[model samples]
Target chain A: MSGPYGTMAEKVLMKGNEAIAEAAILAGCRHYFGYPITPQTEVAAYMAKRMPKIGGTFLQAESEIAAINMVMGVASTGRRTMTSSSSPGISLKAEGLSYLAGCDLPALVVNVERGGPGLGGIQPSQSDYFQATRGAAHGDFRMIVLAPASVQEMADLTMHGFDLADKYRMTSMILADGTMGQMMEPVSLEAPEVKTYDKSWAVTGTDCKRPHNIVNSLYLVPEDLERTNFERYERYRTIEENEVMYEEFMMEDAEICIAAFGVAARVSKNAIMAARAEGIKVGMIRPITLWPFPKAAFKKAAEHVNTFVSVELSMGQMIEDVRLATECARPVVLCNRAGGMIPSPEEVLQRIKEVNGGMTK
Target chain B: MTTQILIAGFGGQGVLFSGKFLAYKAMMEEREVSWLPSYGPEMRGGTANCSVIVSDAPVGSPIVTKPDVLIAMNLPSLDKYENAVAPGGIIIVDSTLIARKVERTDVAVYYIPATQMASDEGITTLANMIILGKLIRVCDAVSNDNLEAALKKVVSARRADMLDLNKKAIELGFNYAD
Candidate 1:
């Protein structure tokens, strides 16, 4: 797989959504169920075009709910299965999300988010941050949320999502905004290092050889449900400790710290470089795993940073996590755009300049 | 070196397709590249644009607010993105469709009658590729070495006959007196 750069992996120019579908296939995902949605239909379209050729199942369900329920059926069989959608459709899939968590099923769900509270515009947005990170559904459960900034990460994390879901026996979400899903970039489609998990609990036909495994989410007894919630929280704590992923840029001597993820992080990097050229001591902490929140990294940055800027596409969602992570010790300001607009590098740099100016006072 | 490019035109003008060609060429040359299109619920007559970045360094943002090269296929696109080009950057306009002079003094502008050239050459649908040829001449968005190889990658095997026609259109623009 060598290319022009000797020994480097050969790369393909693919759209983010297409990369996700391809990577999922490489990761052994044989079943895909999803409805058409803006900014994410390409995921289904790619699967539709390719799945039949490879003897895989690509079902365009009647609705988002039907699609997710179909995912549940395949997931119960302990096979790699997935579904993808955008913001409004993701909301429609929420109950299925809670059920996936409740049943402890392993599956990958991709949310290429667009603007929303209702039927929002089919434009790139990170407004689903609160919906993805905090309130995916009604119950008290957390899904492993991975945010990808580039198309390369979109593919890399799709493979990673499946592995994580299998390891943790729950749903793993690719929480990308429309920009990440729609952009095209060069990506190496090499197979990822995979770790297999024991799926003996899966409800495959027993053939009268062993006891039939039952897959159910209902716990009629209140205490039984409480125990399951406690057990899930215990697993969450373990994931927070062992699976937190983040990247730090120019944080060695930073006076201003910017907290962002996905596309906001990409724009912030551009702004950070410009600020450094102008001699502003600013850096960024980009959380790759949104659920874990990278609390320790932000807490450490808070110890030295004079100000923290929470850049987002939402009104303000991850900013609350930034505040909680930093213990509100540093003043965290918002540099944001809502309803499908992105905060440009100029806007982010301007915010940094303002935060630095306030430090002198 | 990092070159941010913005290509804009009518929806049917192959704006995104041309950007794809440039991105594929850059990838073939082992440069870090990205192509991001302005996608949504738009019909054929609506305006469409694409942002492309070809860089020696990793591309930070795929959304190019300040492009080093601007390829405008129509007047509306020119009026929209003319002011957005960086100082001393290159602006390549399809002169046959956009009848106005560029009003920017800070950037170098190229007015190529791409549509006219393509129509004259009986390759009307390739005005995008014609302007793209001029784009490569004006800036190092992609190397000329991998142009055909890149074209082979994007123009599906079913349309293999188009490979030579596209190359001819590109050569037409590359050697155009304008």
Candidate 2:
């Protein structure tokens, strides 16, 4: 963090996309392959500018699929690689994602999501919740989804994503929305201590030193594929037990809880504060990890709160996770906006008030 | 206290740049700040806007719903966001472009012909800086100290010549009365 970028502790104003790019470099990511898409194009642009300067490769692939395959190529060689795209582009990368999971390759895929279902709009959204958590493509695999709520987390999580991807030998996705990708805030570029893993299994040149390392997802034997699936799930279980991250705001002695992440979580924080000011016992459990879903946090909050309001930019995409996490022990209601519209603090505050009224009645 | 400011105008008018200046000024002062610009097709000669928040505590939502201060550089921006300003907030209109007067009486309004002034001053592209200067003069959104340093950061190295003109335009707006 300190070298080359100089004065790493000094805060600099940066867009969320720029932060991600710079952090990726700090994390030793030398290969970036991405195609342009709205609301997330800055990420590619930033890489195109910085990667060359850092002696890294920033290739603008012909398509999203091509870009993801390029990522796979670098990942097979055991080098840090990344690709970023928006909603539609991410959909195109689905097959590649499943392939990576099948090959057990570690890589970073950033989804600066815009409204979706099909080229929805160039505005912020969380509609890809199911797509991200359920392993975007047709497969019995999982990608560690990190939901960053701020520009700072955008940078922090980019570095963390690289580490986690290497650690679990699986793809770690930074599931950010348009707002989190576009907004600017003061961030410290102070490099974090990066952790490296052994890449003995990488497809490096054998040079007649040993057997050539092969990387492939196709398993001709059904039993071999089944065993690999079981092993991947075992890794996922360890991740679920260890990598769940969340923040609790004003949950102490609270009767109402809000479950949100990314921009929705930020908006919910404002509402929780306003509701608290008005003497309402409202709090929030902001999940930093979406795939693992922070089930423990929700289950614990369900024990104390009367109702859980799920705020999101999409039409309650994350609500299903909230209900399942809490095991339907408490009522989970939706406060959301769709088609790229974001919920205002006042809207969420009103929902909190309504939920409080229902509880009282 | 948190000050939520929104800047709106056509794409070429530096609406996002003005927000960046304010955000950088606040950041230099060690305050929590965020700047969010409208992106997508809007940047290709369409309406562009930016949301900036300066807060004592960490910023929550980067989107400004009810702005404490509104800078309207064009008619559509004024018409669309006039009613969205918080009561007792401040509204600065670029009289050179926006023809109509703000109908809201709850918020204080300042009509600075920034576009006209910048034209007169031979710095037509810097009307955004002029309005920013007026914002600093009228309200303590950000202090004028380190203004040059902030401008230095935002205005790229290639366009360093605009630095002095930008400063002059801001001074013109800062000194304007009535």
Candidate 3:
């Protein structure tokens, strides 16, 4: 597909995590602090190999907590910075993520997820679905989660995550999986056009002519913190209005609507095709942006579709959102395979056939 | 339309390189494509697989569970994924390592002596490339011209001196019959 700029014929082979790292560097990210983890180690490794070449900063942090705090430290100075990890590592960074959100700092966090509740399998898994979408940390904050199903999206979304973080003054996550992190794809190395940010609010060193700016999350006064919370909530509201993205397929006259995202979407696509071939009216709803949840799109389809099947690699985590989105307008059934296992298209097709025979809800 | 494929084998079998070449060909043809390798602990001793999806439309997901085609370079890969190929799909096997034959009759299976062919062609590393050549010829998943262009782009940038050997291996596999 042609990038937003123009049609460039150049192509290079890159892994998904490596592509995200390259995209971040091209997007003006000057500092990156990360701890190594399975599936996502390539992002840190790529940064380690290339950061010095471009005079950028790369640090192998002691832990994910330290890494995320380091990102906040660099970002508070108005310098673009990022950190990345896998599912369990992200759980460790949750405390720092909450602080970043409370402080309203703009930074990027890439989660190349693996199966998990604890130290789950090292294979690709969407078990972190609730952790990413519902805020695994404490507080009233919400994160902007961008789910990329391909290597190109992995690169593009990394750049977009940084931009959105800056625009909304919050943390944004590229919620990818091991499948995406480890995959190699052809990517164009063309750099995106750089845009400067307004650093007037940044706490750069006191060498500036203006008064010193303080970046902090500590608000001793409850009312002041409440105002800050309300402001952040308003920004999130704006994001919900303008940034929700989803892909629809054959939903116009479908009786069964399958909802999935990321790797599940690929399997569901094949299942939908197979089901259609068997004369079943099955379609798919894939949410590209997992944070906003694409409620309107699901609600619109639920009006006509009799069965909404939520297909995922997790045990019914995203199914909650599907149910909420459909508003109980239709029966939402869950078909999932967790712990590093991906659901096959035939399994999904079987579910569609069963649902077609009044075996639902 | 798009074709999603998974090519898998041992670490030193050039499985990843074969997948990369196919993805490169798709990109050169101006198609939307993605190639993903098996990450995490699987890179240790277990089988290694790379998923390559080449499509005319914007590819929504890069992971391939039910691939339209599969290229199995080892016995384990064939055992694991032989049944996953779609009906009327294509399965290209390296008979050099895989002793047992596939049981599925719904898909077309071609058992090529890729390792022996590459050895006969005087280059052992070209086995995967040879299999890729067969894939392009039988499935037409990618055109010969696009494959050659992609091979030039990848090999010239890294192994310029070995271009002749790689081309010869590709031709041997492309021309292999039955």
**What share of the reference contacts survives in each candidate?**
0.80, 0.75, 0.68
Give one digit per residue, the lDDT tens place, for model 2 in A125-162: 99999899985998798999999998889999999999
Regions of model 3 farther than 4 Å from truth: A1-6, A186-190, B1-4, B30-32, B43-46, B54-70, B83-91, B99-111, B146-148, B156-158, B176-178
> Which model, 2 or 3, shows the larger DockQ?
2
Candidate 2 chain A weakest ten by summed lDDT: A1-10
Task: Give Cα-based local distance difference scores for all models.
Answer: 0.92, 0.91, 0.86
How well does model 1 score by local distance difference test? 0.92
TM-score of every model? 0.97, 0.97, 0.90
Supply the DockQ value of model 1.
0.77
Give the interface RMSD of candidate 1.
1.3
Q: If both were scored by DockQ, which would come out higher, candidate 1 or candidate 3?
A: 1
Local error of candidate 2 at residue B172 (angstroms): 0.8
lDDT per residue for candidate 1 within A1-361, as digits (tens), equals 5643345457888999999999999899999999999999999999999999999999999999999999999999999999999999999999999999999999999999999889989989998888888999999999999999888789989999999999999999999999998999988887777677999989999999999998889999999999999999999999999999999999999999999999999999999999999999999999999997899999999999999999999999999999999999989999999999999999999999999899421
lDDT of 2 at B4: 96
Isolated chain A TM-score, each model: 0.97, 0.96, 0.96
Runs of candidate 1 with Cα error greater than 4 angstroms are A1-8, A359-361
Distance from true position, residue B124, model 1, in Å?
A: 1.4
Sorted by TM-score, highest first, which candidate order results? 1, 2, 3
